[model samples]
Target chain A: MKPIFLLRLLVIAGFIGFVEALCRIGIIDNFTMPPPSRIAADLARALASGKFNGPIRATLLNAALAFCLAVTVGITAAVVIHRLAALRTSLDPFFATYYAVPVLAFYPLLIILFGLGSAPKVIIAFMLGVVAVIVNTLNGLDRVPRVLLKSARMARMGWFATATQITLPSAAPFVLTGVKFAVAYALIGIIGSEFIMSTDGIGFEIAFAYNNFDNATMYPLIVLVMIISIIVNMLLSIWEKQLLERRGLR
Target chain B: MSLTRIEILGPILVSVALLAIWQCAYWLIGDIALRSPGQTVRFAGELLSRPTFWPHLVETAKAFVAALAIASLLGLTIGLLLGLGKTAGDVFEPMLIALYSIPKVTLYPILLLSFGLGLSAKIAFGALHGFIPVALFTMNAARNVRPIFLKTGRVMKLSRWDVVRKIVFPAALPEIFTGLRVGFSLTMIGTVLGEMFASQRGLGYLLMNAIGLHHVDVIMAVTLMLVLFAAVISFALLAIDRHLHKRF
Candidate 1:
């Protein structure tokens, strides 16, 4: 077995073991502190029942769509802001505090514009991810060495050509980090929105189970959401590494 | 002076343009559900005079402050524990990181289920949101303390407590402050969201109540207040961070 994987497994197992001990020792009640083994079993049962199928698809679709939109809008805005000092200075304050705002509080207004459908959720997810992306991408572009740009200028390259060929390539690492950050935010946005106000999604399923007091189902569903999101994050990070590595080869 | 004026005017001009567009959109849409910026701001002014306003605002403030306090206490303890202990950090860091990665609000239902629809539930949920970031950040801060700093303490023949209090703590302050900033924001999100989900009182409850009654004016007023509250708190935190940065 890979040593890192083994270590991770051991760590997780140790946690579960501790929880099991606490429950066994009557330090923690089953209702509040369900045994990890029981939760795992419930997960298996829940999966077998295929209860999460629709919600999983719904969340993934919504989050993916919103993330794509965020990426497009964010990168475009970043490039524009990078080129225009006026625009960048004007919008910097708003972007800095974007994360502080209780963005989902505006859901009621969103509902009015888009109706009580997936549209509001999409917008919420987009806003959450896009702000992070814009900030990071702008910072990344700003960090590009002036010497490189000056060299490009000496070559008599057009602004667009210089930016595309020189600036964008060097700034890829930061942009990718922003994208990864956006994905995480997008998922959080979708899940939180779903939990707060949604007709469908893993978040809805969680609220459903909670309302029913089906603790077993609820615990496992939360675990499932974590597991899926973690896997997605790992995949994204791997992709980022590969992209950067390929750039190095070039 | 001219350049400074230009810099200041840039954001103001942008905001003005955006507001104008919003007004234009209001005219075009002509939806009762949507209000003009003037209408919303006027309503917000009126809301300040309402009897229900102070109680709801106070409740939210209480929960927000209480949650941050609890989160800090718990987060610091756990962070220090895991950070100082090599074996513990190895064993528990992964779990803490995994927990942080998950949208913490998902666990809100559990908190609500246990604590019921009340202030405690809101505080607990808020603390949950804030706790992980603070803990993880603090853990990193402590774990990554420079060996040279520790060696300096040893060279001075300092006691263990003295070494940690004088050397380790100052080094970790910046990251700890970062964690607190993130924690504070999460706490705000958690508190507001918890009240929105299920609560008898607070700004979120008031906003949700407005939504239920289709009181668009009240909703707009409450939401604007919430956003402003977030902005003011964030600016305060930023100032504190800057001061600390200067000191360190």
Candidate 2:
């Protein structure tokens, strides 16, 4: 298992090196496409110079807030819909095609309604992520076997106790999986909103650089965004694994 | 899959209620840019009456369909190859996951540089959006094909094509279809994003134009068109999904 993981790392590193060499030798244009080495060096300089810290921190803070809002609102809605058959029946179809909709279309409305700055962007992120959380939450709850509920009642476990000990734990893995998705979606939403309109944050940086035709700066910012995504995904996956293991789901 | 009268009425009633709320919001906001549902209907009516709307809609549609075709073809072929071979799946799965994690939008500039701000770039961007999910789903669906079915085919001395066609494809169709559906959605998103970022034609381009001119009605109209398109496609896919489930 470890060897295979190492091999994967080696393959990626080799691919990067190959690309770097290709660009250096002019097989791939170095002007439009910066070599991986230059990008890496720029990334390190950006880090060391503390030029990116502000934007990274801002985006992270916003994404975190959006994620929390999405989870809270999503779970609340999911629980409500689950308890009300009519609402579930009415809304399920909408939820099914939610991702298909260019949710950014609604961003202009959000800006008009929610006011400017980060509020609209945060809401955009929340809007993008909330559906997945809601759907997965309901699915997790639904999979909490009816037999378990019956047994809980038979054991005279109170509603709160049963929910805490059985329902939540049983549903944790699925919910966590939803969280993994929510994080990604939320980040994507935030960046996209920023790309469309914003003064600061990583998305804004990328857009700013591109608009100025500052390819040197733009390339690194793009890498930064990718790294941020990879890091977030890795963290969430690890967290998900831990939760699944604790629940004996893995 | 058959809906009762109540179930059918449920969504319709909810939509009407939402529209009513939308109109109420319009009243409260008192903004022409943010028009009432009735006004939106009128706006759509007016726009559709014009000759310009058709071309923009067609451009978007053309790019969308072309992207889906390319993504579906490539996704399925590559997915099948990877799924049919465990060694290939194991080697590439991690890398694919990594690539998928990075939002494809980030790479749009490079695509613009490579393909230029043309139909090809938009289609390529949309194809990239669709490809990952479709391929991922197809690979998993193919890999998860029951070993017993394959063994039975082998025991019966079936050829490779026969085993795949008779045993694997049918079993994986449901999940593969799910990927295709998701791919459609992403394709829609990608095409729109490409148009918004940089393009000469399409609803996305129109929307961006409207944004610049503060033609909020047109923005709203374009959004409504996209949403309507999504709903129609989703319902059609749902019907097909049900049929496939029943037939298979």
Candidate 3:
């Protein structure tokens, strides 16, 4: 494990060094991209400058809101749908094909309805993420052991009590999987919508900088977004692994 | 209704129900920004009949096909190589996942800078969006091939290419195909998105153009067409995917 980890680090550092050499030697060119060292410097300056604080906060806040909404609404919808055999059966195809559909295509319509504010972006993120949560939660619910439910019933547990005590605990890992996807989707939705048409957010800032040939700002923001997303994803993955291990499900 | 009957009727019922809701929304919004389902269908027909629409459609199709081709070929090769290396696969899989989850649209500027504002850029962006999933799926598929099968090939003294062709390739084909299906959808999206942001042609460009013009009818029409195209192709691919999964 340690050897593999060291190898991964070496690979990453080597790639960055290669890029740095390219930029320094005019192979990639400064207009196209900056060197890793330059990008790091710019990132530090940007972070300390406080110029991007507003957009960063806005994007993160909206993404968080979207994630929360998707998880709550998705789990609720899945629970309801799980109890209704006909509805679940009828919705199967929709769920299967849902991700294939470009939910972003509806962004224009959302803007029309909600105006050019953060609402549209949040809605898009929620729409993109909620389905994954629903589908995974439903899968988890379906796999809950019937014997466990029977024991709960024997213990005189009510439906809500049984769910909170037995069903949810058993299904936590799968739900975490859904939550993980939701995190990615929410960020994608918020950033993608901002990229397409919005006045603010990190995506808009990048686009704005790009149009003006401000590679300094654009590259650093791009790097920043990459860092934030990768960190969030890694954290969630760690938690998910721990949860699975605890449940002996890994 | 019976299960089979419900299976046949379910999607259609859902479609109709959705259209009804859409029509109701149109009635409520009253045409300043919305189009009724009937109106959207008729407008889409009109747009399809127009010669101007064909160029955009053709451009998008060309980009999508090119991107999917590159993504599949390259992704499969890389994934196969990594999967063959146990340590390499373990080290790189998480990196690939991180790449997969990042909001790739933000990288459009870098693509635009390197590839420029053209078909190449669009194809590159589409391929970037598509390549990871295919690679990830293919890696797992190849890595999971039963060791006994390879052992038998080794005992038989089969050549490397022959072993792969006769055993590993066939064993991994089903899952690889699933990867292709997903890669196909994402490529379409990425190509369209590329057009939306950078290009002067394609259905995505048309959608963006319509938004700028506030041509609500055209927006609805193009969106309707894209959704129909995606849903039909996805269902077809899903059917094949299910068949393969079941057969294996």
Q: Could you estimate the TM-score for every candidate?
A: 0.90, 0.93, 0.98
lDDT of each: 0.84, 0.84, 0.91
| DockQ value for model 1 | 0.57
- State residue A155's C-alpha deviation in candidate 2, in Å: 8.3
Second chain TM-score for model 2: 0.92
Ranking, TM-score, top scorer first: 3, 2, 1
Residue ranges of candidate 1 with Cα displaced over 4 Å: A1-5, A21-34, A146-157, A241-250, B1-3, B143-146
Q: Report the error of model 2 at residue B133, Å.
A: 1.6
Residue B209 in model 2: lDDT: 74
User: What fraction of the real A-B contacts shows up in model 3?
Assistant: 0.64
lDDT of 1 by residue, B197-241 (tens): 768899888877876677888888888888888888887887687
Q: Go through the candidates in order and give each one's DockQ.
A: 0.57, 0.56, 0.75
The DockQ of predicted model 2 stands at: 0.56
Pairs that collide, model 3: none
- Candidate with top lDDT is 3
lDDT of 3 by residue, A91-136 (tens): 9999988878888888877787788899999999999999999999
Residue A92 deviation, candidate 1, in Å?
2.0
lDDT (Cα, tens digit) per residue for candidate 1, span A71-116: 9999888888888887887787777677889888988777767777
Candidate 3 lDDT (Cα, 0 to 1):
0.91
